[model samples]
Target: MSNLNKLDFTTLEVSGRNYLKWVQDVKLYFTAKSLKATIEELIDNEPANEAKKATAMIFIQRHIYDAPQTEYLPEEDPRTFWLALADHFNHQKDIHLLEARHDWQRLCFQDFKSLNEYNSEVCRI
Candidate 1:
Protein backbone atom coordinates (compact mmCIF):
# COMPACT_ATOMS: atom_id res chain seq x y z
CA MET A 1 0.00 0.00 0.00
CA SER A 2 2.64 2.53 1.06
CA ASN A 3 5.01 1.38 -1.77
CA LEU A 4 2.39 1.88 -4.51
CA ASN A 5 3.56 5.43 -5.22
CA LYS A 6 7.10 4.18 -5.94
CA LEU A 7 6.02 1.84 -8.75
CA ASP A 8 6.91 2.74 -12.35
CA PHE A 9 4.08 1.44 -14.49
CA THR A 10 5.58 2.68 -17.76
CA THR A 11 8.42 0.17 -17.56
CA LEU A 12 5.99 -2.62 -16.78
CA GLU A 13 3.78 -1.70 -19.76
CA VAL A 14 6.74 -1.56 -22.15
CA SER A 15 8.05 -4.92 -20.91
CA GLY A 16 4.63 -6.51 -21.24
CA ARG A 17 4.18 -5.23 -24.81
CA ASN A 18 7.64 -6.48 -25.78
CA TYR A 19 6.87 -9.85 -24.22
CA LEU A 20 3.62 -10.09 -26.17
CA LYS A 21 5.42 -9.31 -29.44
CA TRP A 22 8.00 -11.99 -28.68
CA VAL A 23 5.22 -14.47 -27.94
CA GLN A 24 3.55 -13.69 -31.26
CA ASP A 25 6.87 -14.11 -33.02
CA VAL A 26 7.54 -17.65 -31.81
CA LYS A 27 4.02 -18.96 -31.42
CA LEU A 28 2.99 -21.43 -34.17
CA TYR A 29 -0.53 -20.12 -34.20
CA PHE A 30 -3.16 -20.24 -36.94
CA THR A 31 -2.32 -16.79 -38.27
CA ALA A 32 1.27 -17.79 -38.92
CA LYS A 33 0.18 -21.05 -40.53
CA SER A 34 -2.30 -19.20 -42.68
CA LEU A 35 0.55 -17.08 -44.00
CA LYS A 36 2.71 -20.13 -44.70
CA ALA A 37 3.54 -21.18 -48.26
CA THR A 38 2.36 -24.72 -47.71
CA ILE A 39 -1.26 -23.68 -47.21
CA GLU A 40 -1.87 -23.36 -50.94
CA GLU A 41 -0.23 -26.69 -51.55
CA LEU A 42 -2.27 -28.34 -48.81
CA ILE A 43 -5.47 -26.83 -50.09
CA ASP A 44 -4.80 -27.67 -53.72
CA ASN A 45 -3.73 -31.24 -53.11
CA GLU A 46 -6.34 -31.90 -50.47
CA PRO A 47 -7.71 -35.39 -51.02
CA ALA A 48 -11.27 -34.81 -52.04
CA ASN A 49 -12.16 -38.47 -51.86
CA GLU A 50 -10.64 -39.08 -48.45
CA ALA A 51 -10.19 -35.57 -47.18
CA LYS A 52 -11.53 -36.34 -43.77
CA LYS A 53 -9.36 -39.39 -43.28
CA ALA A 54 -6.33 -37.65 -44.71
CA THR A 55 -6.94 -34.66 -42.50
CA ALA A 56 -7.24 -36.93 -39.48
CA MET A 57 -4.05 -38.70 -40.45
CA ILE A 58 -2.20 -35.43 -40.88
CA PHE A 59 -3.50 -34.19 -37.52
CA ILE A 60 -2.42 -37.40 -35.81
CA GLN A 61 0.96 -37.37 -37.45
CA ARG A 62 1.67 -33.74 -36.71
CA HIS A 63 0.42 -33.85 -33.11
CA ILE A 64 0.94 -37.31 -31.65
CA TYR A 65 3.52 -38.81 -34.00
CA ASP A 66 5.73 -35.82 -34.71
CA ALA A 67 5.70 -33.54 -31.64
CA PRO A 68 7.98 -35.50 -29.27
CA GLN A 69 10.33 -36.50 -32.08
CA THR A 70 12.04 -33.13 -32.03
CA GLU A 71 14.95 -32.49 -29.68
CA TYR A 72 13.42 -29.37 -28.10
CA LEU A 73 10.32 -30.83 -26.51
CA PRO A 74 7.28 -28.73 -25.61
CA GLU A 75 7.35 -26.98 -22.23
CA GLU A 76 5.15 -28.12 -19.34
CA ASP A 77 2.41 -25.56 -19.92
CA PRO A 78 1.67 -26.82 -23.44
CA ARG A 79 3.51 -30.10 -23.46
CA THR A 80 0.71 -31.55 -25.52
CA PHE A 81 0.53 -28.61 -27.87
CA TRP A 82 0.54 -30.91 -30.85
CA LEU A 83 -2.55 -32.68 -29.56
CA ALA A 84 -4.34 -29.39 -29.09
CA LEU A 85 -3.48 -28.34 -32.63
CA ALA A 86 -4.60 -31.70 -33.86
CA ASP A 87 -7.88 -31.29 -32.03
CA HIS A 88 -8.42 -27.98 -33.79
CA PHE A 89 -7.58 -29.53 -37.14
CA ASN A 90 -9.83 -32.48 -36.39
CA HIS A 91 -12.69 -30.20 -35.45
CA GLN A 92 -12.21 -28.18 -38.60
CA LYS A 93 -12.09 -31.32 -40.73
CA ASP A 94 -15.25 -32.67 -39.12
CA ILE A 95 -17.04 -29.39 -39.64
CA HIS A 96 -15.93 -29.07 -43.23
CA LEU A 97 -16.98 -32.58 -44.02
CA LEU A 98 -20.23 -32.62 -42.12
CA GLU A 99 -21.43 -29.03 -42.29
CA ALA A 100 -19.81 -26.42 -44.48
CA ARG A 101 -18.91 -28.49 -47.53
CA HIS A 102 -21.96 -30.71 -47.16
CA ASP A 103 -20.45 -33.40 -49.31
CA TRP A 104 -22.37 -36.64 -49.30
CA GLN A 105 -19.10 -38.44 -49.95
CA ARG A 106 -17.83 -37.11 -46.63
CA LEU A 107 -20.74 -38.71 -44.82
CA CYS A 108 -18.76 -41.95 -44.80
CA PHE A 109 -15.59 -40.27 -43.57
CA GLN A 110 -16.41 -40.46 -39.89
CA ASP A 111 -14.07 -43.40 -39.33
CA PHE A 112 -11.67 -41.35 -37.29
CA LYS A 113 -11.21 -43.63 -34.34
CA SER A 114 -7.91 -42.23 -33.12
CA LEU A 115 -9.07 -38.62 -32.90
CA ASN A 116 -12.23 -39.73 -31.18
CA GLU A 117 -10.39 -42.02 -28.79
CA TYR A 118 -7.53 -39.71 -27.73
CA ASN A 119 -8.96 -36.22 -27.89
CA SER A 120 -7.21 -34.91 -24.76
CA GLU A 121 -4.76 -37.28 -23.15
CA VAL A 122 -3.74 -35.81 -19.76
CA CYS A 123 0.01 -36.02 -19.27
CA ARG A 124 1.43 -33.15 -17.24
CA ILE A 125 -0.75 -31.24 -14.81
Candidate 2:
Protein backbone atom coordinates (compact mmCIF):
# COMPACT_ATOMS: atom_id res chain seq x y z
CA MET A 1 0.00 0.00 0.00
CA SER A 2 1.17 3.48 -0.82
CA ASN A 3 1.77 5.86 2.05
CA LEU A 4 -0.08 8.63 0.31
CA ASN A 5 -3.10 6.43 -0.23
CA LYS A 6 -3.82 6.62 3.45
CA LEU A 7 -6.39 9.08 4.82
CA ASP A 8 -4.66 10.57 7.83
CA PHE A 9 -1.59 12.71 7.31
CA THR A 10 -0.90 12.96 11.01
CA THR A 11 0.13 10.37 13.68
CA LEU A 12 3.93 10.26 13.38
CA GLU A 13 3.34 9.70 9.74
CA VAL A 14 5.20 12.51 8.09
CA SER A 15 3.23 14.03 5.25
CA GLY A 16 5.01 14.40 1.95
CA ARG A 17 4.47 18.16 2.11
CA ASN A 18 5.71 18.22 5.68
CA TYR A 19 8.62 16.00 4.82
CA LEU A 20 9.86 18.65 2.42
CA LYS A 21 9.33 21.25 5.09
CA TRP A 22 11.36 19.24 7.56
CA VAL A 23 14.15 18.88 5.04
CA GLN A 24 14.15 22.61 4.42
CA ASP A 25 14.15 23.33 8.12
CA VAL A 26 17.00 20.92 8.64
CA LYS A 27 19.02 22.64 5.94
CA LEU A 28 18.38 26.01 7.54
CA TYR A 29 19.33 24.76 10.99
CA PHE A 30 22.59 23.18 9.85
CA THR A 31 23.73 26.24 7.93
CA ALA A 32 23.23 28.46 10.97
CA LYS A 33 26.49 27.09 12.41
CA SER A 34 29.85 25.79 11.28
CA LEU A 35 30.23 22.18 10.20
CA LYS A 36 32.53 21.57 13.16
CA ALA A 37 29.95 22.84 15.60
CA THR A 38 27.36 20.68 13.92
CA ILE A 39 29.57 17.63 14.29
CA GLU A 40 30.22 18.42 17.91
CA GLU A 41 26.51 18.69 18.66
CA LEU A 42 25.77 15.33 17.05
CA ILE A 43 28.62 13.72 18.97
CA ASP A 44 27.65 15.44 22.18
CA ASN A 45 24.15 14.00 22.37
CA GLU A 46 24.84 10.57 20.86
CA PRO A 47 26.78 7.47 21.77
CA ALA A 48 30.40 7.43 20.71
CA ASN A 49 33.68 5.60 21.00
CA GLU A 50 37.07 7.30 20.95
CA ALA A 51 38.10 5.89 17.57
CA LYS A 52 34.72 5.80 15.79
CA LYS A 53 33.80 9.46 15.77
CA ALA A 54 34.65 10.18 12.13
CA THR A 55 32.94 7.10 10.71
CA ALA A 56 29.90 7.72 12.87
CA MET A 57 29.79 11.25 11.61
CA ILE A 58 29.95 10.00 8.05
CA PHE A 59 27.08 7.63 8.73
CA ILE A 60 25.02 10.53 9.98
CA GLN A 61 25.77 12.43 6.80
CA ARG A 62 24.52 9.59 4.60
CA HIS A 63 21.33 9.13 6.59
CA ILE A 64 20.28 12.77 6.34
CA TYR A 65 20.97 13.03 2.64
CA ASP A 66 18.15 10.56 2.10
CA ALA A 67 16.01 9.84 5.09
CA PRO A 68 14.13 7.03 3.36
CA GLN A 69 17.37 5.21 2.74
CA THR A 70 18.47 5.52 6.34
CA GLU A 71 15.12 5.06 8.08
CA TYR A 72 15.71 1.39 8.77
CA LEU A 73 19.08 1.83 10.49
CA PRO A 74 19.20 0.00 13.79
CA GLU A 75 19.82 1.78 17.07
CA GLU A 76 23.55 1.08 16.85
CA ASP A 77 24.05 2.45 13.31
CA PRO A 78 25.74 5.59 14.72
CA ARG A 79 23.85 7.70 12.17
CA THR A 80 21.13 10.09 13.22
CA PHE A 81 19.09 13.03 11.94
CA TRP A 82 20.98 15.65 13.90
CA LEU A 83 24.34 14.52 12.60
CA ALA A 84 23.30 14.93 8.98
CA LEU A 85 22.28 18.54 9.56
CA ALA A 86 25.61 19.32 11.20
CA ASP A 87 27.50 18.37 8.08
CA HIS A 88 25.52 21.04 6.21
CA PHE A 89 26.82 23.99 8.22
CA ASN A 90 28.33 26.73 6.08
CA HIS A 91 29.14 30.47 5.97
CA GLN A 92 26.18 31.55 3.82
CA LYS A 93 23.82 29.08 5.42
CA ASP A 94 22.95 27.49 2.11
CA ILE A 95 22.51 23.79 2.80
CA HIS A 96 21.65 22.57 -0.68
CA LEU A 97 25.19 22.42 -1.97
CA LEU A 98 26.58 20.84 1.14
CA GLU A 99 23.80 18.28 1.20
CA ALA A 100 24.49 17.55 -2.44
CA ARG A 101 28.15 16.97 -1.68
CA HIS A 102 27.28 14.56 1.07
CA ASP A 103 24.80 12.83 -1.21
CA TRP A 104 27.48 12.42 -3.85
CA GLN A 105 29.88 10.90 -1.37
CA ARG A 106 27.19 8.60 -0.03
CA LEU A 107 26.28 7.33 -3.47
CA CYS A 108 29.85 6.30 -4.18
CA PHE A 109 29.81 3.34 -1.85
CA GLN A 110 28.71 -0.22 -2.66
CA ASP A 111 25.99 -1.74 -0.50
CA PHE A 112 27.16 -4.00 2.30
CA LYS A 113 25.82 -7.37 3.46
CA SER A 114 24.44 -6.76 6.94
CA LEU A 115 24.80 -4.93 10.21
CA ASN A 116 26.26 -7.93 12.02
CA GLU A 117 29.56 -7.65 10.19
CA TYR A 118 29.57 -3.93 10.80
CA ASN A 119 29.03 -4.54 14.49
CA SER A 120 31.77 -7.15 14.66
CA GLU A 121 34.29 -4.94 12.89
CA VAL A 122 33.43 -1.49 14.18
CA CYS A 123 32.42 -2.37 17.70
CA ARG A 124 34.89 -5.22 18.13
CA ILE A 125 32.41 -7.32 20.06
Candidate 3:
Protein backbone atom coordinates (compact mmCIF):
# COMPACT_ATOMS: atom_id res chain seq x y z
CA MET A 1 0.00 0.00 0.00
CA SER A 2 2.85 2.37 0.73
CA ASN A 3 4.26 1.78 -2.78
CA LEU A 4 0.98 2.85 -4.43
CA ASN A 5 2.01 6.46 -3.82
CA LYS A 6 5.03 5.96 -6.04
CA LEU A 7 3.45 5.91 -9.48
CA ASP A 8 6.45 5.34 -11.73
CA PHE A 9 4.55 5.65 -15.02
CA THR A 10 1.78 7.64 -16.63
CA THR A 11 -1.81 6.50 -16.06
CA LEU A 12 -3.62 4.79 -18.96
CA GLU A 13 -5.45 7.53 -20.84
CA VAL A 14 -8.96 7.26 -22.28
CA SER A 15 -7.63 8.36 -25.66
CA GLY A 16 -5.33 5.29 -25.57
CA ARG A 17 -2.57 7.10 -27.42
CA ASN A 18 -0.14 5.65 -24.91
CA TYR A 19 -1.77 2.22 -24.67
CA LEU A 20 1.21 0.27 -25.94
CA LYS A 21 3.59 1.79 -23.44
CA TRP A 22 0.94 1.63 -20.73
CA VAL A 23 0.49 -2.12 -21.30
CA GLN A 24 4.22 -2.63 -20.92
CA ASP A 25 4.27 -0.61 -17.72
CA VAL A 26 1.28 -2.50 -16.32
CA LYS A 27 2.87 -5.89 -17.06
CA LEU A 28 6.11 -4.86 -15.38
CA TYR A 29 4.32 -3.50 -12.33
CA PHE A 30 2.11 -6.59 -12.01
CA THR A 31 5.09 -8.89 -12.31
CA ALA A 32 6.94 -6.97 -9.64
CA LYS A 33 3.97 -7.26 -7.27
CA SER A 34 3.39 -10.99 -8.02
CA LEU A 35 -0.04 -10.02 -9.34
CA LYS A 36 0.67 -11.10 -12.94
CA ALA A 37 -1.41 -14.24 -12.45
CA THR A 38 -4.46 -12.14 -11.79
CA ILE A 39 -4.32 -10.80 -15.33
CA GLU A 40 -3.07 -13.84 -17.20
CA GLU A 41 -5.39 -15.94 -19.35
CA LEU A 42 -4.17 -19.34 -18.15
CA ILE A 43 -3.18 -20.72 -14.77
CA ASP A 44 -0.58 -23.40 -14.28
CA ASN A 45 -2.53 -25.13 -11.51
CA GLU A 46 -4.25 -23.06 -8.86
CA PRO A 47 -6.40 -19.96 -9.33
CA ALA A 48 -5.15 -16.58 -8.18
CA ASN A 49 -6.06 -15.75 -4.58
CA GLU A 50 -8.99 -13.38 -3.94
CA ALA A 51 -6.77 -11.00 -2.04
CA LYS A 52 -4.35 -10.83 -4.96
CA LYS A 53 -7.22 -10.16 -7.34
CA ALA A 54 -8.47 -7.36 -5.12
CA THR A 55 -5.02 -5.84 -4.91
CA ALA A 56 -4.70 -6.05 -8.72
CA MET A 57 -8.08 -4.39 -9.12
CA ILE A 58 -7.02 -1.56 -6.85
CA PHE A 59 -3.73 -1.15 -8.70
CA ILE A 60 -5.46 -1.04 -12.07
CA GLN A 61 -8.04 1.42 -10.82
CA ARG A 62 -5.31 3.67 -9.53
CA HIS A 63 -3.26 3.50 -12.77
CA ILE A 64 -6.03 4.28 -15.24
CA TYR A 65 -7.52 7.64 -16.24
CA ASP A 66 -10.82 8.63 -14.64
CA ALA A 67 -13.10 7.90 -17.58
CA PRO A 68 -12.08 4.25 -17.92
CA GLN A 69 -11.87 3.86 -14.18
CA THR A 70 -15.52 4.91 -13.93
CA GLU A 71 -16.55 2.79 -16.89
CA TYR A 72 -15.04 -0.33 -15.35
CA LEU A 73 -16.02 0.44 -11.80
CA PRO A 74 -18.52 -2.41 -11.62
CA GLU A 75 -15.90 -4.96 -12.52
CA GLU A 76 -15.11 -7.49 -9.76
CA ASP A 77 -12.57 -9.70 -11.53
CA PRO A 78 -9.22 -8.28 -12.49
CA ARG A 79 -8.70 -10.70 -15.41
CA THR A 80 -12.00 -9.79 -17.00
CA PHE A 81 -11.36 -6.08 -16.58
CA TRP A 82 -7.87 -6.53 -18.00
CA LEU A 83 -9.22 -8.35 -21.10
CA ALA A 84 -11.82 -5.68 -21.75
CA LEU A 85 -9.22 -2.96 -21.60
CA ALA A 86 -6.89 -4.98 -23.81
CA ASP A 87 -9.58 -5.49 -26.45
CA HIS A 88 -10.33 -1.77 -26.63
CA PHE A 89 -6.69 -0.73 -26.69
CA ASN A 90 -5.71 -3.35 -29.25
CA HIS A 91 -8.25 -1.82 -31.63
CA GLN A 92 -6.89 1.61 -30.80
CA LYS A 93 -3.37 0.41 -31.54
CA ASP A 94 -4.46 -0.95 -34.95
CA ILE A 95 -6.12 2.35 -35.84
CA HIS A 96 -2.96 4.28 -34.95
CA LEU A 97 -0.86 1.85 -36.97
CA LEU A 98 -3.06 2.38 -40.03
CA GLU A 99 -2.85 6.14 -39.63
CA ALA A 100 0.91 5.99 -39.35
CA ARG A 101 1.07 3.81 -42.46
CA HIS A 102 -1.11 6.24 -44.39
CA ASP A 103 1.09 9.11 -43.34
CA TRP A 104 4.19 7.22 -44.35
CA GLN A 105 2.74 6.37 -47.77
CA ARG A 106 1.84 10.02 -48.40
CA LEU A 107 5.17 11.37 -47.17
CA CYS A 108 7.26 13.25 -49.73
CA PHE A 109 10.50 15.25 -49.41
CA GLN A 110 9.08 18.08 -51.56
CA ASP A 111 6.02 18.48 -49.30
CA PHE A 112 8.15 20.09 -46.60
CA LYS A 113 9.78 23.55 -46.65
CA SER A 114 12.97 22.28 -44.99
CA LEU A 115 14.92 19.01 -44.98
CA ASN A 116 14.82 18.91 -41.16
CA GLU A 117 10.99 19.19 -41.17
CA TYR A 118 10.68 16.22 -43.53
CA ASN A 119 13.13 14.27 -41.40
CA SER A 120 11.19 15.08 -38.27
CA GLU A 121 7.94 13.86 -39.82
CA VAL A 122 9.63 10.66 -40.91
CA CYS A 123 10.91 10.12 -37.39
CA ARG A 124 7.46 10.81 -35.94
CA ILE A 125 5.78 8.34 -38.29
Query: What are the clash counts of all predictions, listed in order?
Result: 0, 0, 0
Residues 1-125 of candidate 3 have per-residue lDDT tens digits of: 98758777898988888889999998998999899999997676778999999999988888888999888778899999999899878787788889999998999999999999999999999
Q: How high a TM-score does candidate 3 get?
A: 0.83
Q: Give the TM-score of candidate 2.
A: 0.23
Off by over 4 Å in 1: 1-79, 100-125
Q: What are the lDDT figures for the candidates, one per model?
A: 0.33, 0.41, 0.89
lDDT of candidate 1 over 47-121, digit per residue (tens): 323443344334323333233334224322231433444333334444444543553334342453565433332
TM-score of each: 0.19, 0.23, 0.83
Off by over 4 Å in 2: 1-13, 36-70, 75-125
lDDT of 1 at 87: 37
Model 3, 39: alpha-carbon shift in Å? 0.4
lDDT of 2 by residue, 6-121 (tens): 42212112223233444454345445532333334455465455345454445334433345335534434333434433333322234455765665565422354776655444
Best by lDDT: 3
Ranked candidates (lDDT, high to low): 3, 2, 1
